[model samples]
Target: MSDFTREPFPDRIFEDLGGAFSMGCIGGFVTNFFKGMKYSSTKMEMLSSGMLFARRAAPSLGTSFALWGGTFSCFDCLMAKLRGKEDHWNAIFSGTATGGLLAIRGGLKTSLKSAMVGGILLTIIESVSIGINRKTIQTPRQQFKEYQRFVQMSENQDKKSRSELKLSEFK
Candidate 1:
């Protein structure tokens, strides 16, 4: 039987970008269509304006998501190479860097804020992922060992600053 319930994360940049863009397109159109409903006076006006708004907004939203996804993928790959590992830290750093760089046009404060938020978000996601993994695929002893490993890595991070740490340290 094919297990089609869960989609695997894509390894390539274009796949990530396309998926992100398509998501943005659907979100933009659906949300804008409903938004257009609030101010529309007639059914005809509501329907037409809703579609018009969606048409105008979807491409821009898709493009914006594409940019974010592309940069995130690039940064993730770079971090993986530099750190000599594929782990949650790469996602966190990539998210933070992507957010900061994308928000640069808004000035230093905005960029810093975005970076912090992005990093925190990724941290939460990775933590949740670890928990889910723990639940799904291990005996009690193995699960405990994995949890210990996660804790040890986090503690090690506190001891060694990112720049000072060697790539081998991640392994």
Candidate 2:
């Protein structure tokens, strides 16, 4: 049977915590690069400072993402469940919004060097995430297709078993 239990509150909170800190880490790296390029140390400070700010902001963003993700996840899960399948695109928009917020928070450019550095950091985060997830999770279409194939295989096996049993009477 499929598990339909409400996702644990702690775990959802944990995502928020992790997301903020991870974004902060990205922020720090970006800040360091800016510092190297002769950008004002103030900008670097802001980026590092943004991490702490992010920690404070995390609960809000996390709760928002979770609520949004949960609501959508439930709806998609229902549609897929009733249709005898699963929908994997459910949380995508929610995740994108979350990522965009992370990118914008400390990655904005007030000047040329800072802009270049910020843009680079944002690109790195986005590209790396896509690459990693691509290696990990199946795309929604792929997931749905796999589920359909499994169902078909099960049905075919049932048909084969039934046919063999019916023919056994002649043996």
Candidate 3:
């Protein structure tokens, strides 16, 4: 009861859920509206069809996004608690759990496949993020040191070229 009561982190779970839902709704509305326009011939028909499609699709898309964001965040929190650390493993496990849980109604095989796909996708995303951050993050002092090293190297190269030219001229 005590463990359950205390949240490990005060996070953006609700925010993520709501944000994803809103984005999904917007995407759904735009996509369906354009689709409707494509199928309709007259201007009035296009507007009618677009409105109809948007009204029908927006909520459904938003709900799907809300489910995914909420479930993923919940699983991520659970995994972080179990692992006792916030890391890529948490994301991978959460992705697997969310996918499996979401696909449970389909069948066991489908759930398993979904789980694998989710885990792999999360893993790849995490790995790429790590790679990209490796060279991008530098403190001001580190940046200055790198700059100084570059200047030193340039000066040494200039000096070497000047000396080589002098030697060649003497010969």
What is the Cα-based TM-score of model 3?
0.74
lDDT of 1 at 16: 80
Taking the tens digit of each residue's C-alpha lDDT, what string does model 3 give over 1-171? 123443455455776688889988999999998888888878779989888888899899999988998899888887777877677788888888899999999999999999999999999998998787777888799999999999999999999999999999999
Ranking by TM-score: 3, 1, 2
Highest lDDT among the candidates is held by which one? 3
- Could you estimate the TM-score for every candidate? 0.72, 0.29, 0.74
- Give the runs in model 3 whose Cα sits over 4 Å from its true position: 1-11, 139-141, 144-171
Clashing pairs in 1: none
What's the distance in Å from true for residue 147, model 1? 25
Looking at model 1, residue 41 earns an lDDT score of 86
> Quick one: best TM-score, which candidate?
3
On lDDT, the stronger of 2 and 3 is: 3
